[model samples]
Target: MLNLLVIDGVLLFLVTITALAVIEMRNLFAVTMLTGVYSLLMAAVWTNMHAVDVAFTEAAVGAGISTILILGTLVHVGVKERRREKSLNLSALLIVTLTGGALIYGTLDMPAFGDPEAPVQTHRFQKLFDQNVGKVPVTDTHHVEAVAHGAEQHGGEQHGAHEDEFHGHVYNTVTSLLADYRSFDTMFETAVILSAGLSMIMLLRRRSDEEIEAATQRTERVDPDTIKTERMDPKTTQTVRVDSPPGSDSSGADKKLAAEIAEAVDSAEQIQHDAPEETDKGDQV
Candidate 1:
């Protein structure tokens, strides 16, 4: 019991620290990781309290699946949380404080841990257990004696005689309650988890081929008029012009550019033609 208490205390401390770190963190990715750490610590605390089923669910869903989903969301929303002016809202703070106080006050009236005389233990469920669920075979003599002693205290001579035959349906009451007595509750909880996973998958799914094609078409439809030439150096006054395609609409600037290009090409041909004749005349001299 001492070891369990120490473990629970350490786990709780770590959980608190992780929760605070997550809240203070500005990076969404870091917050997501801290939240997973918080869930893992909570799972450890639950396990220390012997709530294995709850611990397993917390570890698998909260730490594992939830972290992955948050990461997927971060891919779209970005990893950095937007900066906001830090100011405590008095109304929100008051509401949270009252809610927390109410919860703590409510727990004050609840029974202590493992109280055998608690309402739940002494309830009509005991009769149901005695009728439907038979005694679990006890290998430990101490446990058997304890069961016999409890039966005698309850004034059940028959229970004491057949204590071994009148044990719980399952050794673990939590398993019995979740899997048997409240099966429908468990089923609905499972359905809710399944629905949440499906929703996350749907939200994070890749764009379809049709959507991608439509985006590509929109991109291709960009106006050619929006295209502009890079600014030339100030030392050069001449502007570079694009050669318009044949039979395409041409501006006055383009037509002048085409004419200048044609004249330059003719002058280059004339120079080439005279070059061979000049070479022949030099050879004769």
Candidate 2:
């Protein structure tokens, strides 16, 4: 008992210190790493308390895959904290304090660790072992007749079916509980993990409208004909040229548009009145 207390005290101290350090950390990446360490410490505490299943879950989920997932998220979201203001929000602090107090109050009713007289050991385990071993007739005689009658109604074939469920029984009771008794819970946990992975995939994909539009525009080829070279009157196809003489305060845009129009007109004239000799020379070339 003394050794157990010492181990628990040390693990609790480590967990508390790691948690406080995580809270005090300004770097998000460092915080993430400290949070994993905190989880590992909690797993150590659970292992010391002989809760190997819970310890395995904490180590694999809380410390292992969860840390990797958070780091992957940080790759895109970045590790820097966006500090908009240094002032602490009183309302947030009040909410956190109230929530923490409520949680602490709730833990008051929990049984002490490894208490042999706990309800689980007395009620659930006793009933399970008694039912399996067929010892002590499994009753205090108050409802013996009722229990016998119920057993008669639900025994034999039902009991045989239950035994058949574990036809190749294993040594591990936890395995049997998870695979046989609470199989649906195990299945649902698997489904939840799959759904979370799908959710992460969906979130990490750059699927926003703006991002899609930018990618499309970046890859699109713009045609020269699609570009507006001259300012045209909406009512007519004629180009609107500036009448100001060469060196007035006319804008470069207006000059470029005028030059474009003049070049277009000259090209059309040349195409319409080109000499047959020039055409034949072109054809020969």
Candidate 3:
């Protein structure tokens, strides 16, 4: 019990921290990750509270789908988060808090946990669930391992005789509430997930390499250095045509003469144009 309480307290603390982080984080990706953490903590709390069905749905929808959606958004738009107005939105917060306070006050008359008179674990709740949840046969107690070579398998006919002696309810109420009672909610949730997936595909699907190469070629025409830096072609031992800034002659032939410079450039151009395609390809690379 103490361990459970400690876990619950930790979950509450983490929930608050996630709230603060989501509010304060400048990076949208960090905000999304913190939201996922919040969902995980909530799932843990649901598991601890004996609500296995709720825990499963929370873990799947909140942590799994929510995180995926947020991550998709971050991937396409980048992690930048726009800052909210500096002025406090106090009026809106005050109205919300006041309404919440009123709701909390109304909960004062609610039954305490594990109260004997509470309807949660009673005949009435069972009857209500039975009326709504179309019955499925008791599957969990069907000795799932009985199909394998075992004593139970040998006594398959006897299994029916023993079932009545130790019967368990097949219609779990919480599971029914999630799948049947709120079926539309789950359907809409599925729709939301589909929408997110479609949006991400439409938005973030990267341009093809051919398209990227075309764009790069365009950029290079406007400004050629945008392409890759040149390097020496090892095959033919040719130094690639890498640009050097004016007046910074690394060749050390500057003082030789302007005539020598023009002649060398023309000769180099001629060699480049006349070279075999094999050598030229290596030089381009």
lDDT winner, 2 or 3: 2
Instruction: Provide the clash count, candidate 1.
Output: 3
lDDT of all predictions: 0.67, 0.67, 0.62
Instruction: Give the winner by lDDT.
Output: 1
Give per-model TM-scores: 0.56, 0.58, 0.49
Clashing pairs in 3: none
- Residue by residue across 1-285, what tens digits does model 2's lDDT show? 899899999999999999989876778899899989999999999999888998999999899988998898899789988777555778878999999999999878978867888888885574343334232222444553544555557642222223333333566667766775678999998999899889977977645575455445543422222123332333223323234332222344544555665676677568757754445345442
42 in model 2: Cα distance from truth in Å?
Answer: 1.4
> In terms of lDDT, which candidate is stronger, 1 or 3?
1
Cα lDDT tens digits for candidate 3, 193-283: 7998899778776664655665464422222221122222232112222443322232323223333444555776787778755253454
Query: For candidate 1, lDDT tens digit of each residue in 216-276?
Result: 6542332222122212222212323244322233345544544554565567678868886
Model 2 scores a TM of 0.58
